[model samples]
Target: MAKAMRTTPLGGTRQLRRWHRARILQAIRAEAGISRLRLARKLDLSPSVVTEAVAELLAEGLLVEKPLPPTGQGRPSVALDLEGECHGVLAWEIDLDRMAVALLNLRGEVRARAVLPPAPDSLSAALEQLQAATAPHLSGVRVLAAGLSIPGLLEPAQGHLTLAPNLGWADLPLLERFRAALEALGLNKTLAVVENEANAAAYGLYALGSLALEHCVYLSLGVGVGSGVVVKRSVYHGARFHAGEVGHISLDPQGPPCRCGKRGCAEAFLSLRRWQEAPTLARLGEMAERLAQLSAVVLATLDPERVVLGGPLVEATGEALLRLIQAKLPRYALSVHAPEQVALSPLGREAALLGVGALAADFFMEQMAYEEVS
Candidate 1:
C-alpha cells in the first residue's frame, strides 16, 4: 500500500514575511541578474513566498525583472535586479583635508561623484559647503537617505561627534546639523546616518563582497591612523560606540606625540604626515614594521580573516608597503595566521564614501520593508 503524503501551508507571519523580503532583496543585490528560481534556492524559501514578496517589491518600484535569452528550454526565465536608475542614497566622507560625495544607486553603483573643497573650520561653514556641493546632484534624483563618514569618535546613537583631532572639532551635533542641512535642501523626509571613517570603510569593504570571510579589519592611514573592525559583516562598535581607535593604542609610552594628545600612540608613529615627510625606503620599512606590529595585535585580539590596509597613505604607497607589512606580520602574529592575511584595499580613497552610502541605502530598504509588514 502507498502512504499518503501530507503538506502544510506556506503561510508566514508578518515578521517572517518582512525577513523574507529583506533577504530576497539582499540576495538579489549580491547576485545581480539572478533568476527568481535561483533567488528562492539561494535563500531556501518557497517559490510561492519569493514570488509574492517579489511581486510586492516590483509594485513598489524597488526591483525590476529583465528577460533572459532563450536557452531552447520549455520557458525562458527572467533576471532580477535593483531599480537603480530611480532611487539613490547620498554618501559623504568628511576628512581633515577634503570632503567627497557620491550618489549610490540601489544596485550599489556610484551614479555620480564630486570632491568638494576642504571642510571649513567652523561647523556652519562646513554645512553651507556641504549643501552647495550636494544640491546640484539632487535635482531629479530620489534620495532615500544620506550617510556621513567622519574621522574621529562618533556617538551615532546621540548623533554627536565627540572629537575629531585632525579637524579640531568636538562635541558637534553632527546628525542634527546634517538633518537641518537636508531639510534646508527640501529633503525633510530623507534619513541620515553618521559613522567613523574607518568603520565606514570596513563596512564598505564588507558590503562590496571584497572578502570571502565575514570578519576582517580595516586599517585606515591618513592624517591619522585608525582601524575599523568588522565581525560577521557588521562594524563592531564597542560599549560607547567608539571601538576601533587602534591609532591610540600606546605602542611606546615615550614615543612621538600624537594629535590625540597621547605620547607614543600608534598614530604618532604611523600617521600619513610622518610618512610623507620622509618618503624613503627606510621610513617606509619602519612604517610597515610598525603597522605590522599593530596588525599583529589586531589579529591576536580579533582573529579576523584579514587586515586590510587602506586610506590616502596606503593608496600613495601602493603594494610596495603592503609587501613589507605582509613580510613582517608573521613575526608578531600567531603561527596559525599567515602573512598573506594582510592585504591592500582595492577601493582606495573612495572606500568610506561608498561604504556609508551602501549602508544608508540598505537601512532605507530595510525600514521600508518593515513599515510595509507592520
Candidate 2:
C-alpha cells in the first residue's frame, strides 16, 4: 500500500549518521533528563554512538545538559534535555461542535491555546476566523508547521477533504484555504498539514513520551466512531487512505441508514447524541456490544499491543465506559488471542491537537537532519 506522509530514504554513511542523530534527539525528548548511558541502552546503540549524537545535538542547540543527581559512586553522570523554547508548532482541530487551536513548544507543552467561536457555516469562514484568532499567538514565535485535524475523510499529505458529513463539506481543498489564510496574515513560512481527526489522536497518544508500546489502536468516539492504527512509530495508511474508517464498519445489513448510503453501519449506532439524550440500560448494552465487537475485530485483524479509547464519549463517561468495553471484548472476540491491555487515552480531549503537533515536530526534526547532511 502507498503510504501517507512518506519519509525519504537515507543515502550513504553521512546521511545515515544524520538519521541516527535525529533518532537520538527523539530519544532525549522521550526520556527527559536521561543520561547518555541510559539513552544508549534504551536505543540499543553503542556508548560512542550516543556520545557522538549528543555532541551533534549540542552543537545544533537542540539539547541542553543537566547536572546529574548524586550517584554516590564512580564518575558522575550527565543528563540531557530538549533545549527550552527553541521553537514551537501550531496545532488545530476542527470538530463537529467546535474548533480548537493550540501552540505547543518543542517539548510538546502547551504555551498558548484557545477554542474558536464554534465552527463557522462554511469552511472558508471557519479558516478566516481561526487564522485571525491564531495570529496573536504567532507573534514573535517561530512556527515550523501547522497541524490540522479534521473530523472526516482527508488526503493527509495534501490537506484535502473528500467529505466531512457533519460539516456539510465535500471535496474541499482545505490546505489551499488554510494556506491562503496564513498568507493573508503573513505566516507564509509555516508548513501546513491536514489529517483525519482520529488518525491525529492516535498519533498523539503514540507520541506520548511515557507509553512505550510499538503497536496501538486509537478508537475515537465523538460525533462519529473512528479509529487510527499505529504500527511501530508510524501510522498505517492503506492504499486508499481509508484504512481506519472504522466508523463505516457495518454492524447490521438491515438496521438504520448511514451517510455512506449503507444500512446498519457502526456510526449510526454509536452516535454520541443518541447516548447522551436517552442513555437507557438497553442503549448502554447496545453500545457496549458494538464496542466489544469492534474491539474484537481490531484484535483479530491487527493484534495491536494495546487499544486506547478516546474522544468526547470517553471524556464524558471516564473509566465507566472503559470498564464496559473491557468487559465485553472477551465475549465478542472471534479468536482466543486478545490484547490484555485496553484503556482510556491519557491525552484526553487534547489528543488530536497534540498529535498533529507531534507530527509537525517530527517533520521539523527530519528536515533539520536532511539539511545537516546537505
Candidate 3:
C-alpha cells in the first residue's frame, strides 16, 4: 500500500493532478521503460492516481507505452517512455562571433542545428536573422519553449540585457524581442527564457546529470573571462544579478587596462585575446600565476565542489592549461580542496548551447504542467 499525496482545499485538486503528471513524466524520463506499477512505487502514489495521470499523458502524445516481456504473469506489463519525436525545444547562443541555434527533442538530443555569422549592428536585423534561421526547422516539430544564451549581463526577471561589451549591445528588452521573433515564426505559444552564457553553461552542466555536483563553478575563459556559480543545481544570481563577474576582480590598481575600463583587472591579464601570439613557457607560467590568484579568490568566496574551466582558450590550450591551473590551485585553495577539484569542461564550446537547450526543456515541462492545470 502506497501513501497518498496529501492535498489542501485551495486549488488542491488541480495542483495535485498537475504534480502527479509532472512526477510521472519526470520518473519516466529518469528511468526509461519504467512500468506503471514501478512508477507508482517509486513515486509512492496509489495505482489509481498513477493510472489517471499516465492515461492523460499518453493521450497528450507526451508519453508512449511499449509491451514488456512477461514471466509467470497474468498479463504483460507495459514500459513507459517519453515521446521524443512529437515535441522539442529550441536553444540559441548569441556570441560575439556567431549565432548558434539548435532544436533538441524531449530527450535532450539535438535533432537539427545551424550556425550563422554574427548579427548586424541593428537590433531588428538580429531578430530577423534569428527568425529566418529558426523558421525552417519548425515545419514538422512542435516547439514548446526556447532558451537564449547571450554573452552579457541579463536581468532575467525584467527580461532585459544590461550590457554585452563585446557585442556593443546594452540595455535592450532582449526577452521581449526574442518572443516577438518566435511569434513571427508562428510559435506564439512557445515560452522564452533568457540567461547569460556562462550561467546557461553552468546550469547545462548541472542538468547534464553526469559531471556536475550540488555546488560547482564554471569558469568561462574566452575573449573576456567570466564565471557562473551553481548552487544546488541553480545559478546563484547575487544581489543585482552581477554575482559572477569575476573577470573584473582587480589584482592590481595600476596594471594593464581591461575592457571594463578598469586597470589591473583579471580579464586584462587572463583573457584569451591577450595571449594570441605563440606562448613561451614564461608566458604560460605568468598566465598560470594570474589564474591561480583568480582561482584562489573563487575558492575562498564560493568554496564550490569543483571549478570547471571552459571556453575557446581552454580548448586551444588543451590539457596543458588544465594541468597548469591544477598545479597552481594548491597555492590558493585549502588542503581539503585538492588540485583535482579543478577540471576542464567536457562539453567544450557547445556547453552554452546545450545548457540553453536544457533550460528550454525545463521551461517546456513547466508550461505543460500549467496548461494541464488550466
Q: Which stretches of candidate 1 lie over 4 Å from their true place?
A: 1-17, 369-374
Q: What ranking of all candidate models by TM-score puts the best one first?
A: 3, 1, 2
Q: Model 1 over residues 1-374: C-alpha lDDT tens digits?
A: 00011122133487567667777777777788899899888877899999999998899787899898888968899999988877788988788878888988966799888898877788778778878888888877889888889888988767899988788899999999989988998989898888888888888887874675478899999888888888877788899887898888988899888766889889888877887899999999998888889999999999999899898888889899999989998888889989988988767888898988877877775664454443
Tens-place lDDT per residue, model 3, 1-374, is 00112332235587768868876876776689999999999988999999999999999888999999886749989999988875888998888767888998766788889998975786678778877888888887888788899888888767899998888889899999988888888988788898899988887778764785768889898888878888876778889999899999998899898777889998888867666774667777778788877887888889998888888788778688878888998887777777887888878888899988887887666554554454
In model 3, the runs with Cα more than 4 Å from the true position are: 1-10, 369-374
TM-scores for all candidates? Answer: 0.91, 0.86, 0.93
Candidate 2: Cα lDDT at 329: 81
Q: Candidate 2 lDDT, tens digit per residue, 1-374?
A: 11222254457777767766777777777678999999888877799988998898898777889779777987789989987565678888788767898889777899899887657778888887778778888777778777788888878777788888888889988888877877787878777777788888788776763566568889999788889988877878778788888888888899899878999888888878878987777777788788887788788789887778888877777776767777788887755655356778889888888988888787776665564455
Best by TM-score: 3
* lDDT at 45, model 3: 90
lDDT of 3 at 327: 91
Weakest 10 consecutive residues of candidate 2 by summed lDDT:
1-10
* Candidate 2 or 1, higher lDDT: 1
lDDT of each: 0.83, 0.78, 0.81
